[model samples]
Target: MVLDIIFLMLISSTSHVSANSTTVLPAAAAACSNGECQLRDECSTDRDCAAGLYCLSCPLEFRGSRCVRSTISDPFKLLNNSLPFNKYAFLTTHNSFAIRGEPSHTGVPRFTPANQEDTVTQQLNHGVRALMLDTYEFKDGIWLCHSFKGKCHDFTAFEPAMDTLKEIKAFMSANPSEILTLILEDHVEAPYELSRLFRSSGLDKYWFPVSKMPRDGQDWPLVKDMVANNQRLIVFTSDRSKQETERIAYQWNFMVETQCECFLFSCCFHLWIGL
Candidate 1:
């Protein structure tokens, strides 16, 4: 079963990598109509908006999109980082690698649908704590893809899995207080390849061992403890057998998931509903 949501993280600290990172909220920007627009203020470009917002347009909603909140509340930072890992909610991006305007491979324009408009690094900077990635064994290696008929053709492939994992590694290094979860829709048939991929990406240093995961319904380790130990990366694979063979956490054994299929707001959406 290919899961639609993969990783979750406790976003507690800011990264120095974001060029637009700022905490200042100018008082005059609220009234200005030309530039430096605040929330609910009119804007024409992303630069015209404040730090955490961007100019957006919706054909059905009025005429244009106003500055809206893009960052999620950090429970760890708001209260404390000592709480159990599962005690806080996280923001997740579905099919994060199916990015819009991604350059085509195989010298052919991609016909597959795109699921995201920003890069993985941008999503992380914007407080997206989780990412859903579809991994398949293609072209002799694991690649991020939008699987069709359970196969990853050249047209559907996004990029090598290592690229995104390296991005995560860089983000983790820049923000030491954060904890991330990666949920993999495992289609890779190669034995132990997943383990190698993480190691090669330099993410192995932060791997959260499966032995530490709770089998029964129980609280996870404190966010502070995970950061201190540097076991900040939690990975889950859909393939059940990997739990034993590759030492990767089998997602279903730990949590219950229901993928939301509806795209419209009026349509019913499924929830995680807990373990």
Candidate 2:
């Protein structure tokens, strides 16, 4: 009876060992097939992976064989240390009033706010890269704010606008890998006041333009000074005359030659360049 009990015990122990070995073998093989022993956790591509391993996707700001994080400190670092001057342009499609003719107008037209928003959305959807908004418009023989033009709209004060501008600047600072190029088009405004407003708003870092032709007496010295101070600002002349066009071409060519950035007239009818 004692000999029979010993034989039964030996059989039970052998069976247990066999079951454990069967369970462990597949797991060990899987680990080996995944290259976990050799590559550890670092992998770039599927080719770098073993039979059971696969590639994983990385963040948008990152680019590498292994989908590793990027080393770039800032996301919005401008390419070539300058904005693409003439690569894009835009023309405002919606007027303050409903009336729409050409982009340039002598008086404010009646336009619904909802319609303007819808138009902006459509332009954005149709690969419109930029938008130009007439911040101030000449109406009733007086200059009126386009944002609040024909309606009793509750608008943010200048201080709040400045604060919002700071927040935007902070966001850009945080996301340096992202691109945020805004061109402020000052339509028939005093350069000094516009520059002051931008500076107060903490948006002086962006490229801004003051229209030159309509305000004839103004000098380019302010623009030059702004540019010299590492502020991206340019002078824009309307396409009024053949001589003017030639002058623009010459000035544009000089800017290009000197590696200075400037915007040009765009072919797209509805799009306008803006900040």
lDDT of 1 by residue, 1-275 (tens): 01123334322222222122223433323344445778766567777777777676544333455665566577668878978787777767778788888887656577787767778998888777777788998888889988686799888888889889989999999999998878889998889998999989999999999998764556678889999999998888999999999999888777664453454422122333234
lDDT of 1 at 258: 47
Q: Write the per-residue lDDT of candidate 2 for residues 1-275, one digit (tens) a residue.
A: 00000000001011111111111111211222233433233455555455434443333212332322211122112233243333222222322121122132333343422223223333333222222233332332212234443332223111122333454456545533222322232343333443354467665554343332112222222322333444342322222231232222112211211112222311112212112
Q: State TM-scores per candidate.
A: 0.82, 0.28
Clashes of each: 4, 21
